[model samples]
Target chain A: MAQHSLEVIVENSPGVLARVAGLFSRRAYNIERLSVGPTSNPETSKMEIVVNLEGHALEQVIAQLDKLINVISIKEIVPNAAKAIVHDTQPDYQN
Target chain B: MSQMNGASSLVASLEAAGVDVMFGIPGGAILPAYDPIFSSSIRHILVRHEQGAGHAATGYAQVTGRVGVCIATSGPGATNLVTPLADAAMDSVPVVAITGQVPSVAIGTDAFQEADIRGITMPFAKHNYLVTDPADIPRAIAEAFHIASTGRPGPVLVDIAKDALQKLTEFNYPNSVSLKGYQPKLSADAQSILDAAALIAASSKPVFYVGGGVIKANASRELLELAQLLGAPVVTTLMARGAFPDSHPLHLGMPGMHGTVAAVTALQKADLLITLGARFDDRVTGKLSSFAVNAKVIHADVDPAEIGKNRFVDVPVLGDLKFTIAALIPALKVALAKNRPDLTPWLRQMNSLKAAYPLGYDTPKDGSLSPQYVIERLGKISGPDTIFASGVGQHQMWASQFISYENPRTWLNSGGLGTMGYAVPAAMGAKVGAPDTTVWAIDGDGCFQMTNQELTTCALNNIPIKVAIINNESLGMVRQWQTLFYEGRYSNTSLESKRIPNFPMLAEAMGCVGLSCDRPEDVDATIEKAMSINNQPVVVDFRVNRDAMVWPMVAAGTSNDEIMIARETAPDWDSQEL
Candidate 1:
């Protein structure tokens, strides 16, 4: 199955990450790439959540994340795009 | 691109990430970074040694549940940090190590104090960065912090070439980093939760084996609720010392090496071992084949690698601890309330077993201070909020036994690595993390002498941490092993003539008050006096009995049932009386 990358923006808080990640886990979606950091604004953080799933399942994962309270937006950043160059450059070797 | 010093941009990025402190020891290679450290708002604590700095950062990260930042120079300084970085990695503590490397021009030419630190620390670090260009500094710092503090938190290293730090570049720090293959599984399936609940409900003897993940995921409330509802006895790992209230009826102290007999026995007897946020480390499960052999394991952890790494898991739920626990709580509550399994009989049996192999110590009639008594008294006087940071050895075990840590992040120790001299610096970090809480550094004479120089750092920062030293006049743990297993061969275990500097005198030299207690009666008074002084650090040398050994110890490679309780029973002591 092809891996799909989804970027989620949420409020930087204690349990927000857990909730957002919980959404995909409930559906049994395998998260392939997940990155979270502060956005330009301090109050919010952009989470780049990538999961390996069929195209149809990927769409549902994005939609489910968008439904969260603190979630501002959910974008499917192409997994092979230049934006993911950092991860591609250094293969995640540690298992 | 606008021109800005790489060091300045690095500092800006760190500050942007809300990092307020940098613990390190400066050297020639890192002079540029040190310059910015002084001008910037972020505070710098110059540790006596680079290793202490890394551990201090770990201590800070563990207590605050934030990414700790530490810096060091090239070669030796960076090498010193390797142990602490490895220690942090082993414990899954979030720490970021920023080290200055030799200039780009001198990279492979064997420049002065040059070392392949990035290569050295690759296995130990979650991820590492080597900044050859000035422009990469900003992105590297941001990514380093992100990698360190994120899912299944661990240490990350960023090696900046000295030339890069000195060079100027555009100060644009990347607001975000996109990485592939680093996805942290953060959610538990609803069905998995149901399955876990079913197992919990079906099993008559269920036990919750918790680790540092409980604190990391902030799932204490959920863990407590599940345990209470199911009436399952909870045994916390050494790293998860304070995850559950030590005084709770279900709290079966720490389980692993030096774990209480009751707790380890419970693990063995449990039909269902619902491991939440705990990896069955070898120390905790001495021989994996014999560990919880009869139990149906339900492992719930954020890290997927830990699922079947040690023991076979009947049900593996890969998700954040809080979410998994939250999902399981409702199901467990319903199942427990409906079925109402009479766990009272099992609990009574466990209590009986605990009573049979009770952890106790004898007060010498010849009038010598006991480390156990001192720690117990300290525990009694201190509030639940008081934090206990400990150094390795018998004193650490004593502190683990006597100290009743009720809250998560309240107890910090080098549990996985068992690094000596971890207490004082770690306590400094804990005090920094939680300024209002009473932080105590419980150290042994042998361990205290290893990093006592950090007292200057505490004094400089005016961080008032009370340090209680259990002076046994020998390396108590090793000596005990030698006495028991080696037929008292004695060889190098005796610390006689090691001549530790009088702690009180050394404390005075470091601009702090110090006290010494020789008599058992003076322990309370000494601790009180030390705690009262809030302005500066205080060190108390507690002259404990030399031959004191932590009892109820399970010999290595032995089953949990093989525990050595106290040699003799005292008139005042009765396990059932409590």
Candidate 2:
């Protein structure tokens, strides 16, 4: 299984974290590391989820995550650019 | 603006959403909400159990094409809804579930009748909310219904804290819910539609693999148009029984395990498969690697994830089936104008295969009533317009196989989850949804005992749903597996139904008109008598042969190629040439 990372922006609501975590377990996808924190915007949060899944499984994972109504946007963060993306997080995050 | 408690706001929100009726039992946490419901125009059917309320909501939604609603309290009452919520999620039924939560201050303290229901149902519900603030009641309820009834459609849950319910709040219902990232696509990409049309025009053996989404989108008319234009055969899945008419010349019946031979073989031998709104479920694909080995699939579905989740597709169209099929018809017409492939020989081969292996069963040598015959008779007496609900088991399969459905939503069963005891309550809900039409619950002896108490709910509510129990004195499907795979050990499968609480007596005790038929000749008369009684619920216990089995079955985890026409009989696949 190849390790992949996804940066997901979601409405910062109660149970949003649990909803994301529960989806992984329910669909039997393996999660390696998950880091969640409040975004610059108080209405939404950012979640950097790392999973141990192959290319096809990663696509399915992305599609499933996209179905969550609270989820705003998702992008695949390359390993090399992860630091730059994380450091450059600003308050202007838009929905 | 009127000020009221959050509980009253919840009722007002549901009423504004146009919910005519709901199902549930009142409890401490949810009791405040019941006060408004009692005086409101929206009718609330007090179910015997929370599970029944959930499944009934699903049934109502399935038949009426509207969002069904159910309510329950904290702890066990909320948790009991897990099964039906899962069932609705699996079947893509539109249902909104409301639960009362513990007081916000005492939530983590594990106060009396407290459970984190919002967290528990998160895995399956389309979306969920935990509202601790009384002011958020209207918004949460509005979003819950919007999420439940739109997109691909599934159950949604909204849990309000007890203190929030009691707190006075100003109510303002939202004109429209606006979820930032939840947009359901209604139309497919134009290029994908053209590509699918080209395939349909060029392919010799093309099969329309229809799923429940067609019915969900109300696109059966468009499907018929496309199929007739191409002169190709159509095969509906178990969840899609009524999406395509059974009597249509181009229809090949249900496909998958226990599917008709023609339907199964057409999929296996097809050059192109037009898969509409169906996920390639394991029961249908049976050893996925070997299924439809030669077919290039064009999968169109409302859920983007379902397109390539199981099968590789030559063309993937992400849109509602209603629009996808409508778009395809015109594109296919244009493609056919260029070069239409003759499908006569392919259609001939399928017809012959259908005739060679038509669905039939043998009479029991012991003179016991045949389950298949009884179901066939039941379907004939009830007619095509009648709505049929079934519990999981041999009887469920028989009901789907024998019944003729011409209209969408006529057949309602727990196809994906295969939950037992779904028939009675679901049928009750169907009756409530479509009061003018007849609704029948075709259940098994084992399945009946699971939720038969719902008969009391139906009788008291004046729902008047009819039930026919195909009693084989054992779990027939499990016994069939044991008979074939486990050396006939029997192994606790028997219910000893012969000596148990007599079914007719049990029905009468529950305030229903009960009848029993042990012999073959009495089946029709018993059904007719049950049909005649519209004043209250009716139950007819049908004593059938215990050893009967569902044939044309592909055993668990096997390939469709290994399907058996009967015990030890496989089809001569080589003889058929297309």
Candidate 3:
């Protein structure tokens, strides 16, 4: 299984986090990393979730999440793209 | 804005949503809401248990094509609604469940009669809201109904704190809901429709694998038009038993486990499968990898998640089935105009398969009634217009197979979740929803004992639904499996329920007209007697043979190619004689 990251923007209402996270647990997909915070739009929050799953499984997870009524949008962040930017900024940080 | 308490506003919101009926049992947390229900125009059926309320709501929703509402209080009452909520979620029934929660301040303290229902139902509910603020009642309710009824419909829950219900608030029912993330695609893309049409035009062997979405979308007419145009055989899934006319010329019976040989064989042999609204459920697909491997699939569904969730989809048309088929008909006509593939041989083969392996059950050598024969007679006597609700198990399969359905919303059952105690309450709800129509609950003895208390609800409320209990003295389906898999060791499957609580006496005790039948000759007269009683609910206990099992079986997780025509009798799929 490969790690994939998804950035989800959703209505920052009570239990929205549970609703979003519940899909993964219900489907038995293990989450590798997760973070959440209010976005520029006060009404909505942004959640970043990373999971280890195959391509088809990840696609199903995305589709299930997209069905939620409170979820505003979802985007897949390329794992390498973020690493490349960090590398360019500080090449010797990890070393 | 009108001034009122939150509870009143909640009821008012339901009224505004055009909900005329609801089911529930009042409890501490929900008592406040009941006060307003008396003054409101919505008719509320008081059920014996909270589970009954939930399943009744599901039944109401299935038959009416509208959101069914069920109310319950916190703690056990709220938790009791879980099964029905899960059932509704699995079946994609539109249901709005309202549960009372502990006062906001005491929620975490585990106050008396407190339950975190919103938290409990998060996994299954289409959407849920826990309203703590009195001012939020109207908006929350509006959003709840909207979420439950739209897109791929399922159960939605709204839990209100007791204090919130009691607190005085201004009720301003929203004119419209603005959910940024909840727009369901009503129509398919033109290119996708065209692609599907081209596939349909080119394929010599095509089958319309119809599912419940056709009924949910109210697209049966469009489906009929498309099937007539393409001249492909139609196979309705269990969840979609009545989505297409059973008597239609191109219709092959239900497909999957316990499905007709003709329907299952056509699906197995088809070159192109036009799968509509039906998910490729494990029950339907049998062994997933080997299932219809040669068939190219054009899956059209309202939910995109369902398209490739199980099987590979060659063409995915994401939209409401009504709109998808409406768009496809014109495209298919155009495609067919150029190169029309004659489907005569394919249709001929389907007919031959259907004729060779027709759905049948032999009469028991003993005098005991055959369950299949009972169901067949029941269906024939009730006619096609009657609504049939069944509890999950052998009886449910028989009802699906024996009954000839010509209209949508006429068949209701727990297909996905396979909940056992679904029939009684669901039939009650169906009766309420369609008061002019005759509704029958075909339940197994094992299943009947689960939620038969709803007969009281039906009797008291004057929802005169007829109940036909196929009493086989055991969990027939489980026994069938045990007989097949195990060395005939019954192990806990037997429920000597015939002697205990005697169904007829139980029905009479619940204020319903009770009748019992042990012989096949008395089945019709008993049904007629039960049917003639329109003043109150009627229960007919049919003591059928315990050894009888649902045949044409694709034993769990096995391939449809290995379907058993009878016990140890596999169909000869390799033969070219047909």
**Each model's backbone clash number:** 0, 0, 0
- Model 1, B365-451: lDDT tens per residue? 788888899999898887788889999999998898888889899888888888998898888888888888899999988888888
Output the lDDT of residue A87, model 1.
10
The list of candidate 2 runs beyond 4 A from truth reads: A78-95
Computed on alpha carbons, the lDDT of every model, listed in order, comes to 0.81, 0.90, 0.90
Error of 1 at B163 (Å): 1.4
- Return model 3's CA RMSD, one decimal: 5.4
Clashing pairs in 1: none
Tell me the lDDT of model 1 at B401: 85
- Whichever of 1 and 3 has more DockQ, that candidate is 3
Clashing pairs in model 3, backbone N/Cα/C closer than 3 A: none
- State the lDDT of candidate 2 residue by residue for B1-578, as single tens digits: 69999999999999999999999988999888989999999999999999999999999999999999999998899999999999999999999999999889998998999998888888888988889999999999888888888879999999999899999999999999999979889899999999999988889999999999999999999989888988899999999999989999998999988999999999999999999988888888888778898999999999998878877778999998999999999999999999989888999999999988888899999888999999999999999999999999999988888888888999999999899989998998999999999999999999999889989999998999999999999999999999999999999999988679699999999999989998998888888999899998999999899989998898888888899989899988788775
Instruction: Arrange candidates, best DockQ first.
Output: 3, 2, 1
lDDT of 3 by residue, B39-103 (tens): 89999889999999999999999999999999999999999999999999999999999999988
Instruction: List model 3 lDDT by residue over A1-95, tens digit each.
Output: 45888999999887888887788889887889999998889999999999875456777889999998889899988776332211011011110
Pick the winner on TM-score between candidates 1 and 2: 2
